[model samples]
Target: MEQEEALDWTIRTRDPDFRDWDAFTRWLEAAPGHAAAYDALMLADADLPALVPAEPLFAGTPANDRGAPASRWRWRWIGGGAIAAALVAALSIGMTNRADIYTVDTRPGEVRVIALDDGTRIEINGGSRLRLDHNDPRFAALDSGEASFTVTHDASDPFRVTVGDTVFEDAGTIFNIVRAGDATRIGVAEGEVIYNPDSDAISLPAGRALREDGRGLTIVSVAPESVASWRQGRLAYDNAPLADVTGDIARSLGIRIVGAPPLRFTGTILLDRDPQRFFARAAPLLGVTARHTRDGWILKERDGPQS
Candidate 1:
């Protein structure tokens, strides 16, 4: 009886002119499972017609034969079949949507490349976490770290990435995004993207980058090649702060760096297979010495002179 009422509500609510939303809300809130049952019926409404033939199910039934015992049994069987068909359809749709959620994570010194069902490709940098929903192929969430995306062209479903409160939407583009603490930096390599925050939306085209922090948003032009350079085992820094660069290196190498003297360096640093070797090469360039401890590498000021 409850299922029957739920099905009735589903049909009524689907009407184009249905306007008793408050009453419907009251009905749904009246019982705990009422809403779930109605939702099942709605899914069945979409899928049951495709799987079950209406002509064969209703064609031979006559309205005047309701008094006969066999006729009553036949009607019950048909009703049961319809409800069963709707339940099956609802379950199938639920499974399909839930199965499309894909999650991938990377450890330090590891990079992963994923080719999604929709032909979109994602390069997840070391120590990054990302979730992609194939049901909504163009939407994803970056929980932490950095990633580069080569989104397939699907005008119907533009690519969108959410990092905290900020959203980056692209029609079809190659872009890189990094999330560190409260700061987010997005760089576009190919095509364009729309950067949206609470206040406004900014259109960023190829060879441009945007950084958002406590102060505000800043836009700058960057070389396309400089974007996602970590894919080639190199990290390029152009006047980036010491804190930011060390943080990136630590994440990439899967190690910890502490006591880094405050100084900024500008150059490309090759990430060798050995984390110690990379640090040994990088430290002296900044006029610092690399000391290896149990925790990780520590950068200290060189005794001679500052670079």
Candidate 2:
């Protein structure tokens, strides 16, 4: 069968009415190729079929149509059978290497500080994902989210943060990189970092920034202390929009803020202080009043206050 036909069949097999456990088991037993096809469809990594063409799978089905209920006997039989089959496969395949993998995730309203084996300190912001290979020495990948790193001085192996084609590397420096969709905003706080893009490379010193785009790199200057302020529980901004400042605030405090724009706030507030107090200081700067609403805090223009 063609790939399209196999996909169609797989879709139909997952239908609510296709709950005949015996029939499905018999079909799997009748042909090894069928089982392989199912696995291929389910296990195709990276190149898996896109869901755009899967609309027909639910053509006539309602949204509320739940899958078939479980059967105790069927569940027990399938569970035991799977265990036996897995044991056989494991014995045949022997041991497979799964590389040293480490995941550090932060839940909403939570802050996490971790120390790696290399003596590097990492403070992960809320709603972030940090994937590290505890063994790979030459380099490591920062898959997504924002993280402040105090890299240990290591002339032997330089730390690298891979954000798309651009790679930020430094042997002994502190920096923060926030991955926002296609673009990555990097702020160098201490020492120097090499921002490399393909064949080109640019050295970024402390209090400097380099924004990477599809075309090339754009260099700019930033205050080093402001970028590293997260370590001290503070959101420092200078000529930054309300949107950008709010994002940093939400990440640092693990709280959500929703309100209108034109909130031009530019100042530094100690994040360790009470969140409400921080908002009070920020609101006056932005010409807005901070109020507690159903969803965290909302900053709006004051009703009436003489300048």
Off by over 4 Å in 1: 1-100, 197-199, 303-307
Give me the overall lDDT of model 2: 0.62
- Using Cα atoms with residue i matched to residue i, what is each candidate's TM-score against the true structure? 0.64, 0.61
Q: Once model 1 is optimally superposed onto the true structure by TM-score, how far is the C-alpha of residue 263 displaced, in angstroms? A: 2.2
Q: After superposition, how far is residue 99 of candidate 1 from its true place, in Å?
A: 8.3
Instruction: Pick the lDDT winner.
Output: 1
Model 2, position 136, has a per-residue lDDT of 61
Residue 7, candidate 2: C-alpha displacement in angstroms: 33
Which residue pairs overlap in candidate 1's backbone? none
Model 2, span 122-238: residue lDDT tens: 888876776666466435566666788888877777888777667888847999887655657788899988887345667888998766646556677888988867777777766
After superposition of all CA atoms, the RMSD between model 1 and the true structure is: 18.0
